[model samples]
Target: MKASIASLTALLVTSITALRPVFRPRAAAAGPFLTQVDNETWVIGNELWNVTQGRTYGVKLYYKDHDCVGDAVGHYVSYNGAASNLNWTSASIVTEGTIDGSSYIDVKFTATEGDMHWIILSGLAGAYQYFVNHNLPTLGEFRTLWRLDNTTFPNGKTDVRDEALPPLSEYISTLKVQDETWLKPDGSGYITKYDFSSWIRTQTYYGVYGENFGSWYINAGKDYYNGNHLKQELMVHRESATGDAVQLNMIHGTHFQVSATDVFPDGKMWGPWLWYLNDGSKEDAELRAKHEFASWPYAWFEDEAYQTRGSVKGQLVLSDGRPATNAAVFLGDSSPNKTALDQGSDYYYTGYADEQGNFEFKDVRVGTYGLQAWSNGSKIADVTTSFLQNNVKVEKDHLTDLASLEWQVSAKTKLFQVGDFDRYSYGFQYGGSPYEHGVVDKCPADLTFTVGSSRTEDWCMGQSKLGNWTIAFDVPKAAAQCSSSKKNATLLVSLAGYSTGVSSNVYANDVLLGNLTSGGGIGTNYTATLLNDPSLYRSGTAAGEWRYFEFPFDAAVLRPGAANEVRFQVTRNSTWHGFMWDSIVLEW
Candidate 1:
């Protein structure tokens, strides 16, 4: 009984010692066991069992973060290639427990099966790494890479191919095969699988040996190529590919001769044959010289060439060469000998005088045109200004001048400005001083008005009654002393009157204190208004600037050169607000 008790105690002690936690290996604490399988890298992070495919092939990753406290637990692959959730399915994992009562972790994996060539299990987002593993095949599974966003190859429609799929078998072997190891029947050479970075370097690398290279296999769709290689072509851009530098094996025996400035350049496009070719030697070039091309004969004066007309410029002037303002101009051709177009039936356009008296025609065809000018909408005269012969017979390569002729417009009478006035007094215009008296202060030369302000004062000389009347400035002349009967003479007046209203019933045009009241307002105390209308006047609340008023008298109104009487009337409401007038000038 003593021996049995000792043995049982020892057995229990041994079991308790084995249950104690063991320290994890230091080497594994830094990282997981790393190895390459089929040119891919596999790593075990905090989440165990991670796999990464290299750049050549699409990546595959694996990760796990599960607690195994009571017993060992991990995922496993069954014989049928399906994975088992429990870790005990495989005994291949090497494991250890933590000393500080933490959970144990382990990772184990094996080769994959089936057509799922690319798979991933990752904890980090957007992180990618490459490796050279011995597990993956040199020639990967053949599949469609990418497709174009445009239509089919040009050549019209009749040359469409039946098969749109790529030759995957041929592509798989060719692409994976290294440049150093060309295709050999024995297949013993080292097959190289490079990523997009290495491929781009290989393409853009133009070295001293004159070896030109480019991406032979693009993501472009198969629809771009017809049965004939003549349909689609590749261009060498950036670095020009000379004829001697062409890579025979770049496109499976296909070669291109192109410069850095080819049509496609670095961008891929599908177009006609000649647009893609850049053969250095004329032996393969198709040249079409301009001199060798056919010519279409036509005559034109290139300068005045009006093709589809909207607006065009034509010049005109009076006979004395002064700028003819307000002259009406017409454009069209009329000659009895010329039968190309009917004189009256041809297209025509009319132009009105601008400030410079020049006219322009719109929507007229390219041809010679006649011009006519009139005054008062009646026929003045028809002078032969140079006819506009637009796009007429001329050398095709040289430009021609069309505006080489001059127009001489003539008129019987010219108008001019005589002595003008803002306001004047007739017989017995009273209640004002000598400034209001009807007489020339100064004729033909210069005249100035002397302004005197009186606040709520009585009427002055030449006036009947007065409230707040300012000294009036007047000028007297007959309308006959002014310009021609065909034109209008103008007198401009600008002044500010007191804003004193004599009676509520008196309109601005009605007589107030024996004289018609023009304008007097209380708003803003200062404003400019036109004095042309007899019904309107400008009055102010206080002293303000001179505001202009112009009155245009036509031939009938002016009595055809009769001198006119003008007067400046000043009256105001409230009797206190007023201003003075000064220095008035006249111009033609």
Candidate 2:
């Protein structure tokens, strides 16, 4: 009996010993097994763990708080490519822990086939949101914690684990411009980098070259105007294959100021710049970089032809003997019988008169040029007399001074005017944001305004699709009486912008004045479906140039010492017909 009992005890001990080995936990594998596939792609598993199609895999990201802002929350990850089933919202945080000194997060997702090309990360840190892109290192890098430092290297450099990466200039030197010259628009001529560079160097400006992630860029500095001006800066960029080339990219207006002269103010500089070129692939980044490098220190600036420049200075005075302050002056190629404003394929230079009405164009190319000037202020009377000065000669290293250019008014007497002549619908109702469809539909059907009592805001910004606007005024006994000796009254309608095939029918007391159409203006066909929302047209932003429509009518239409009405109705043609009015004027 004792031997049988001892045998049972021995058997129980053996079974317990075998089970103890199974319950003991094995040591966890040491990680981060990361391998870079390209600039933006990475392999996250060990060599034996292959990424197979239609399988599940674990994704781990190690993030270092280099800025020490705080731990980023609200993590999001996405798998890119057509084959990948995972999206931005698909992957969720499964676990969070620290690996070495860096914060690490683990996420689980179903693996895709060959179509899984990229992984993107985004999260919030303090008031700012941080984006981590495999391609855009400027935003942030997930691999090895690299960040951009411009002061250390030109074209920017990235540091990985305390090691500095090579600057973008080192890579850009290998690229070459394949075409001899790029064809200019309108089939006018061909343009080379030399042509652009030469013109750029003539202006006093600041510049810088930097890299954001894998993309390279050049900030050619802002224009003479300080803030929020149209076409303010000149910029060139070499974007990555996945980068958005259409979106305007901005930089600090003052941070990268490399020039001694302060031409632009300290603020955010807006972009789309002047030029944008894309790198077709990761390997093609160098090729795109070539254009940005070529413009820096613009080689053509060294040529004697570019160095030889002259200056043009002048003062503007209105016919009433008042200084035309803030008038815009332009210089264009000397073409006989052509105004500077009409030149299409010439180097254009612009300047503004100071408060004292004095203006000057510096570093102008040595050549004869046609000069044109116009007041920036709203005109009370018709200033239709041409200010075009033909064959204004400029010699090399000399100043061409034309003291006091006179601007004459076209009409002998002023009758009445509605809205300002500032070539914009800024002060009128809905003018501040008029780039939308269905604005005319929202306006009052019987829109009427009395001339003296009506404010600028009472006028609608634009008319569209058979909409009509009425202007009411009392005709004085002396001015309204028709006489054989008096000249015929003239009506002028100025448009800030318009759609194609737009026209207006003008009537005085139901007498047809004329069917008015745009003489010359910026025309666009907004083909998008009318959503009746503000975003239906141009996203509520202003663009394009002004046009004029004139009508001459007999003054007999006016009744002496009585109420008069001048009505304008858009000619019905198509659904998208429209025009933004700048001013309406009547003169005798």
Per-candidate TM vs. native? Answer: 0.16, 0.49
Candidate 1 at residue 482, lDDT?
A: 40
Q: Candidates' lDDT values, in order?
A: 0.24, 0.41
Looking at model 2, residue 56 earns an lDDT score of 24
C-alpha-based local distance difference test score of model 1: 0.24
- Tens-digit lDDT string for candidate 1 (482-559): 433345433333232212232111111122212223253333212233222100011111112223334443333322
Candidate 2, residues 1-588: lDDT per residue as tens digits? 235223322322111121111011012113323222222223332111211111222122112211110111111222221122223213333444442343333433322211122111112111101122222111110111111123311232111011122223322322322222233343443222111111122222212222322222322322211211111112221122211111112221111111111222122112212222121122344443354345532232223544567888988887777677776667765654432322322245677778777889876657777777764554332354436777887788799999988777574556677776655566777764622333443445457889889997898776665667899988777765544357577777776555544556678887777765543322321111111211112222221235566677777887768998899776553333356667788777
Q: What's every prediction's RMSD, in angstroms?
A: 37.5, 21.6
Candidate 2 residue pairs that clash:
137-213, 138-213
Instruction: Rate residue 211 of model 2 by lDDT.
Output: 32
Which regions in candidate 2 have their CA more than 4 angstroms from the true location? Answer: 1-300, 335-342, 378-386, 432-446, 481-484, 517-543, 573-576
